[model samples]
Target: MKLYFINEYLGDIHNTGVEGMWVYAEITPSKNIDKFNDFFAALVDEENDFEEANFSEEWVDDNNWFVIDDENRKKGICIPAVYPDGVIAWRWR
Candidate 1:
């Protein structure tokens, strides 16, 4: 399974239920792929530590990360910008 490092925000915008805020970190690969099992284990441990340190939410059931601001708004999802990271960009489709 491929791993992704993401930042998420949870908040409200207008008169609607808001998923709030989200932010993503630079997603990097587990370097030591030779020891895939151990590498994944270490990654999991590191991910847990990171969650505890920052978002307070574990990287589990990574579905439904965000919601729209108004009930009438069409359902859409946010995705990473096409350009390089740290570009302060987004593609909401």
Candidate 2:
């Protein structure tokens, strides 16, 4: 899985920034795409909040993740950004 961080502003407040990160996983002949999608979807749904979200200590130590806004706490992460190709589905954080 390839991870990308897209920096963008959230909510009406100016100067407050957040990362809209996405994961891109290539499906190959040996890969089970359905299972992969289901796993990621469930994981995202379960740990949608920044405070409640779980990440590896190594990942956290290496990279900065999402920052939740007070107003958008209920919005959660893992919004799907669909593309025409259908293979490139983004899990927006």
Candidate 3:
């Protein structure tokens, strides 16, 4: 399993009124970022609920959305400043 610092909440497809929070997911990393984006684009958790985030055709950018970190250190609330230049991948748990 790989670790990812993700901002899945603020994308165009979903939201939870908490855009500043990030999820440190220990997931099976995806092969590529496109696959990662597609997987999440279709992800809709009923338990979590996204029927109010106004579903869209797109989400975050492949080059600017997330980063894969095994050590689990990426500040989503304050990014590019605290953590600059890191490998981004589609992490799955």
Candidate 4:
């Protein structure tokens, strides 16, 4: 139930599709154990949010979160480098 907005470019050269994304967030308990397990079910539930949304299993395998590219990349907001909430944060803002 937490949200994050990483203002810094954290990905490295080895990372492709996301490495150039400008910014991204890492959400844990991501997709959840239930949905994740359902994904591997022999007969996957066709109605699953992930399946319905057409999110690749690989995307789920890797962490999933919000990503954005905005002119205000590092503007107007700031949070601790290591936030106490340990849930949501706006790094390097």
Candidate 5:
């Protein structure tokens, strides 16, 4: 099983009434997201702090994100999204 972590940052300029940040993680087949269709949904339940967040699939860069004590070795992939006020988003897949 593998853990996928996803997050989004809505910067000060978004003005979408979105603040702070979001984080989510789930366990699935290693390096194969196709094996876990319900992964994102599970994360919504797993990450109680960010229940309102959502996930979208895309290619992520490796420069904008990092793993903090990722014992599962699942933190590395980074999907980059540019938000207003230089906000950066990332997802580990």
Candidate 6:
């Protein structure tokens, strides 16, 4: 599954920085949303000791997660706090 980081500015798990910047996922033939969601949920769980306020570039890298660069199409996990909604896939012609 393709993970997306919706909000990068505001530090709110329930609220995204942008009005419509909700966590989104694009499931491909090789990707599974259920697995990704399960993994993400575990990380965000309070018992996991994950602190949204402590999220950082180094932290992401250490945790085997990454951000999306528009210029380059790379895949990696993103912050879970901003992902309050379901995955979205758009098709345009």
List lDDT for all candidates, in order: 0.30, 0.33, 0.31, 0.30, 0.34, 0.37
Q: Which scores higher on TM-score, 3 or 4? A: 3
TM-score, per-candidate, Cα-based: 0.21, 0.19, 0.20, 0.17, 0.22, 0.30
Candidate 2 per-residue lDDT, tens place, 1-93, comes to 222222433212122223455544332212323323433344345446433234344323313323334554523334332222333333343
Alpha-carbon runs more than 4 Å astray in model 3 = 1-6, 9-60, 75-93
Most TM-score-accurate candidate: 6
lDDT of 5 by residue, 1-93 (tens): 222334432112122222344333322123443433343334334446433234333322344344443253435545333322233344543
Tens-digit lDDT track for model 1 on 10-50?
22232222233533333232343222333224334534542
Q: Stretches of candidate 4 above 4 Å error?
A: 1-18, 21-25, 30-33, 38-93
Candidate 2 deviant stretches above 4 angstroms: 1-26, 29-39, 46-53, 60-93
Q: In terms of lDDT, which candidate is strongest? A: 6
Worst 10 residues of 5 by lDDT: 9-18
Q: What are the per-residue Cα lDDT tens digits for candidate 6 across 1-93? A: 233333222111122133343444432322333434444554556667765455444434423434444454544543343232442322211
Model 3: residue 2 alpha-carbon error in angstroms: 4.3
Candidate 4, residues 36-91, lDDT tens digits: the string is: 33333422334543243454544333233333334323232232122122222332
Between candidates 2 and 4, which one is better according to lDDT? 2
Superposition error at 26 for model 3 (Å): 13
Query: In candidate 1, what residue range of length 10 has the lowest lDDT sum?
Result: 81-90
